[model samples]
Target: MGTSNKPPKLLRMEDYPSWADKFETYVQALNYETWTAVEEEYIIPNNENGSNYRLSQIVEGDKDQFLREKKMLNLFQQAIKVENFQLLQHNGSCYSIWQALLNKDRGNPDMRKSKMSLLKKEFDIFTQVKGETFAQLVERYCHLVNEMKRLGIDKPDYEYIDKLANARPEEWGTFIMFQQSNPVAYARLNLARFIEKLEAHELELRKNHNMKSTAVP
Candidate 1:
């Protein structure tokens, strides 16, 4: 029997469409930390439809940033392309399968398993927050504030700081603002830790709800 030739690989990054190549180049220049921060701030929420209310602002912000630094825009585009490619590779090329998995009722066990595996892999790549409870987060925030005060610095306002350090994942914007203010050298550092804790809480909520449903049988 004649051997079947494998399909050629997808176009190289340089051979991609002009826009895509530009974006890819921009993304390649960013350090992993900055790239991850940008992805978490923009791309993830957009994928989940969490940016519906802020779509205009998000687009405008992107345009302004891109205009100011074409490289940054290119990186943003590249990161999104990479994410899409990963999803497609995982789920196969069947749009029907994708739709079924996206639809709550029609989703199959296999699809769910695949998706859970993907989520686990992605979550593992991030730094998990140390504390799991709300109180623990609050305590960390207080400690951070006190440390700043001890150094004879005008610390971030306690009220605003508490609001963010203890916020739910849905309140991600609040935490981003806190990171920007940088009341302490560890502001973003602590915020990343707190976000990891929130991810654990969200998973627990899903698991408990699923258990409650199964128990009804």
Candidate 2:
């Protein structure tokens, strides 16, 4: 998409890696000088009080460099969709904007190595979010697993099931305990089958809850 007139739109935060790479290539190809500007400076602070334009006017006297920086900043603005841009609070400059988005989606360089640990923590703490639908929970669960895979933490299907069981909500306690006691049966389960079983158990829990709620006092 960056090959076309328009640069690739990073529709989802997860797509940043490829999108950033393509956008970088596009910027370099479009104008090497603009790419040079990006490496030259980080974003200037913006505030109604006062903005430190042109690297706090460090490049202010250098008219040519200042112009290149502005042009690169404009390109960053245009690259992101208007609505998406509005949704974010990106600082000006190619370096700052890129760094901001990168940190937002994927943590900074220092945090990169520990990303697997962070994902594991996320998986460990993950549970049905308040007011989240079963389908939505499943979607989030799947995404987390994919993230773990991206970080090179591939596990057997049954291992995934074990983790999922531990992450389930309180309503799933009985079903989880049953599975826990029957290791062989649970070990045979894959992601889909495990989720299917959870869904069925959820319905039973719901039915019982409804029955008790409607019971005569």
Candidate 3:
């Protein structure tokens, strides 16, 4: 049988704070002494092969290099603080605007104008959609209107279901109820099935209308 050697123990750096501090102090002291010795040894020009560069040259070069590095470090630290402050200020401004838009009291005119402008832009975009039936328009408008209501935006006096029925009487009864009651669930699960049914109904209507037109001819 072969004998196996045990693995060496591993110590974590975090587990020896006091020892690490003491070790660092001892190392710094040794480094200073060794650096002095190297300086003294290099003063006499002995023609050793690779030991041509003296400690004095390295230290003198490193002084300027260290100062440049420190300046760069300080610049980055200040930049980080400024960036954080700007982010906080922007966040606060957005929050204030949102609160003002949702407020019921007749407050700032600028806030009211901003809110109205946003609403008008949204409405105009919806109104401009080509190839969308009146029913589609009603659905889109109802959803936006409902969302605004949920967010404490001012509600219109007219009923959404009534508007939907006026737009497309054929689909309004079923579609409006489902949209109003369960908008999320209707969108996620029921829209495809509802559209399929609407297509079938339209097909049937088209067939019946064609038959009537032929009979009249």
Say which candidate scores most in lDDT. 2
Q: What TM-score does prediction 3 earn?
A: 0.26
lDDT of 1 by residue, 106-180 (tens): 135776566555544432342215555555645554444443333233433443334554344544555456555
| Residues forming the 10-long window of minimal summed lDDT in candidate 1 | 1-10
Query: What's the lDDT for all of these models?
Result: 0.41, 0.74, 0.41
Q: Give the CA lDDT, 0 to 100, for residue 3 in model 3.
A: 13
The TM-scores, one per candidate, come to 0.22, 0.47, 0.26
Tell me the tens digit of each residue's lDDT in model 3 across 79-148: 2234333322221222232232224222367866676667656644444255786457646776666445
Q: What TM-score does model 1 achieve against the real structure?
A: 0.22
Cα lDDT of model 2 by residue, 134-214, tens digit: 778888899899878755778789778877777677767877888778878877788999899888987887899899999
Best by TM-score: 2
Pairs of residues clashing in candidate 2: none
Better of 1 and 3 by TM-score: 3
Superposed on all Cα atoms, the candidates' RMSDs to the truth, in angstroms, are: 21.8, 11.3, 24.3
- Superposed by TM-score, candidate 2 places the C-alpha of residue 50 at a distance from the truth, in angstroms, of 45
